[model samples]
Target chain A: MSGFLTLLKRDLLLALREGGALGTALGFYLIVVTLMPLGLGPDLNLLTRIAPGILWVALLLAALLSLPRLFEADHDDGSLDVLALGHMPLELVAASKALAHWISTGIPLALMAPILGILLNLEARAYPLVIATMLAGTPAISFLGAIGAALTLKTRRGGLLLALLVLPFYVPTLIFGITSISAALLSPAGFQASFLILTAISLVSLVLGPVAAAAALRQHMQ
Target chain B: MTTDAATQTWTQRLANPTRFMALSGQILPWLTIAAIAVVLYGLYLTFFVAPPDYQQGETVKIMFIHVPSAWLAMMGYLMIAISSFGLLVFRHPLADVSAKSAAPIGAAFTLLALITGSLWGKPMWGTYWVWDARLTSVLILFFLYLGLMALRSSLEDETLAAKQTAVLGLAGVVILPIIKFSVDWWNTLHQPASVVKIDGPAIHSSILVPLVVNAVGFSLLFFALHMKAMRNEVLRRRVKALRMAEVEQAARGRDTSSATAG
Candidate 1:
């Protein structure tokens, strides 16, 4: 556990210090979100209606933008081999990296979503729901993304392949994330059902992602 | 030992690639005959024998094609999943080819399903497309097939590519049920006029018989195509090996001559 935490801290430190992954993803998110109105015109009612979908999809893409760096750099530099042999297991290393990605990219993206929400004319009432759903949902993106990152770890310039492999898996999260926020406008009960389903998706992926990624890493990491 | 002997015999005998190649070569002709016979007969039955719908009229004929292709679309993915499982868990030699063969076949069937479904829809539902759950889910399934093919093609290492794609292929199996559930919920929310439910008892016996026949025919067709593709893949790998050996030989020849000259 301590070893896992240490790996997580080291990755988080690296992400913060290099300042590229997190900053670029957040900037991309801002730009993508900011352009929604410019593309669709200044229809506040329309923007607010589509806000959850726009926010969730843009957030997913931004999260995806940083996914390639998660395993590629370590694998290229031979650090992953060392980490694989470290106190923690390969699966734990995978989990820790995914967690670090979430902490660095996911959290920042989720936090920045509401700020972008204003630009999209998101409802003031749905603010907490948007943030809450994002927080619950973002881990699944990072964790599942680790599997893609691992599978393509050996291929040069594998970003497109990673996106292809990862985005289909994002369907459930995107559906439920948008659903829960939209449901909040209907009833508390409806919102709870969808929100819980979204959380279940994240937690399920959090477990499956690392194990699958570790399996791929073991297979492909030469 | 005798009780287990028979089971092991089939497994051990076919497990060898050479053995599989010989057996499949012998069986391919018969499989082709069966596929052609069944599909031609099925199509005949579909057009002539299956009674026109009292409601949908002749437009219901599209269901014969659409329904079977949809079944194959789902079944193709399942075939890939099963092959992938074999590759991962049992390390079967032919599993990668089996998985590889299924992707394009599955994508073609999925495209057929969407197109036929649309044609049937235009007449019945008065619109060619709607965001209903089944259509949306099937569209996603098509993308999944494309993604699998893309992943397989991008990697250079034959063994590693096979294993990695097998892993992704297995993960996609989860989407099947989610598509079912989400689409059901989505259609319920929208409550549009459904064309033919496509599932329940509303399908008449005349239509049902041809539908079943076409489904069996399509399965045979998929088998024949899959086997032929796998055989071609084996031959392709052999050609690749020969070329690689030639390249290495040339490189070694240059190295030795340079050494002798020095």
Candidate 2:
């Protein structure tokens, strides 16, 4: 519906005006990738072998850093209360917010992943696979984080708790994302399975996540 | 509608806190006895009765413990999700107790699975730990259990703790499918499922019969322990209330005594 799109646009515009919200995530991703080679030593072979994991992990953490702000701003300013009372179903509202989150955080991370992939000396063949996996996997991050953000909306010390609740859910996406690239680099025949699985996970999350988030929000407001 | 009288009475009886407590208290010893007996028999069958694996030899014995423990870990999370749904939908007090009790039991099962897995891995895989799909996902489940328990403890309000934990419980469901499908998704060295397949359990009955028995035993063990733990939680709540009441009484007495002396 138009309402959902409008809500998504509003969220995106808000993130744009905030200035450093998007920058901070990318900066964290860049720094984590830059630091890995220094700590792991400058062996190109070693870097290449491990680059997929490092890239995937950095993307995951960067995606996670943007999660707490998803609902905190709206909740703090009382916009969330207004939104809750609006005409749209809460699940639709949650879906819109999650889409906005993916656009602001997940897209930027996906765009920057390739540059970091190069820094870690990833194989040229693996670049497309890395991008593809990040594209497929990051939406799930936003969708799932909505539940965490909703649960901790008014709780004290929510940031630490948010990380605790969300990270375990992140493991599968992390594994699949990294494995896609690894499979691509190691054996071309198997990479397709990983990609398909990642896609399947994202599709399932996309459908189920908004409903779960709406449930959490309903519980919170009560 | 009056509905089924017998079934309604059973639910009503369990819903009554005091009656449930007394009933569970009476049944606890018997369930505990059954659990212990079954587990011991399972262990005996695991070691002496089951034939050694042709390829794996003695190391396969580890599967008896590891497989059951792992199965229970997954089942525990499902229980959490179910109890959580009950809390949110039905507003049942017992559901909250069930969810809280499940966390520690789940954590214990997770640890048992990990340890037995490592013991098996040492001989089979030549290493105890790998970032493989099956191992990693299960480890994440263990951490999820830890996080749930931590979240429960961090909140001061009982209602808030219960609500927040239910949310976490529901959110954790996302991992189940991933855990189930990770082997098919990735090129991990871990072997694929041997039981609960579309074609039925892949392993022969010789190995699987004891495995099922132990699995049932472990499940019953979880239920019995969980019921006892929930009872403890209720008692703990009561004791806290009683202590707070006594403190208030003492404070009032002190104030009255001071006023009279003045």
Residue range with the least summed lDDT across 10 consecutive positions in model 2 chain B: B1-10
Q: What TM-score does chain A reach in every model?
A: 0.97, 0.96
Error of 2 at B69 (Å): 1.1
lDDT of 2 by residue, A1-222 (tens): 998989999999999998688999999999989999999999999998888889888888888888888888888888888889999999998999999999999988998888888788888887888888999999999998887777767667878888888888777677678777777777889799878888887887887778878887876676
TM-score of each: 0.93, 0.89
Q: What is the lDDT of candidate 2?
A: 0.86
All candidates: DockQ: 0.64, 0.47
Fnat of candidates, each listed: 0.54, 0.41
Candidate 1: C-alpha RMSD to true structure equals 3.0
How large is the C-alpha RMSD of every model relative to the true structure? 3.0, 3.2
C-alpha positional error of residue A165 in candidate 1 after TM-score superposition, expressed in Å: 1.4
Best by DockQ: 1
How do the residues B130-247 of candidate 1 rate in per-residue lDDT, one tens digit apiece? 8776787788899889888887788888899899899888878887776556645664432332333656556567778888888889999999999999889888988898999999
Report the C-alpha lDDT of model 2 over B1-262, residue by residue, as the tens digit.
2465455757555767887899999999999999988988888889889999999998988999999899889889999999998898888878888899999999999999999999898889999998788888889999899888877877777887898889789778767776778788666878888888988999988899888889878988998999899999889988999999999999999999999999
Q: How good is the docking of model 2, by CAPRI class? A: acceptable
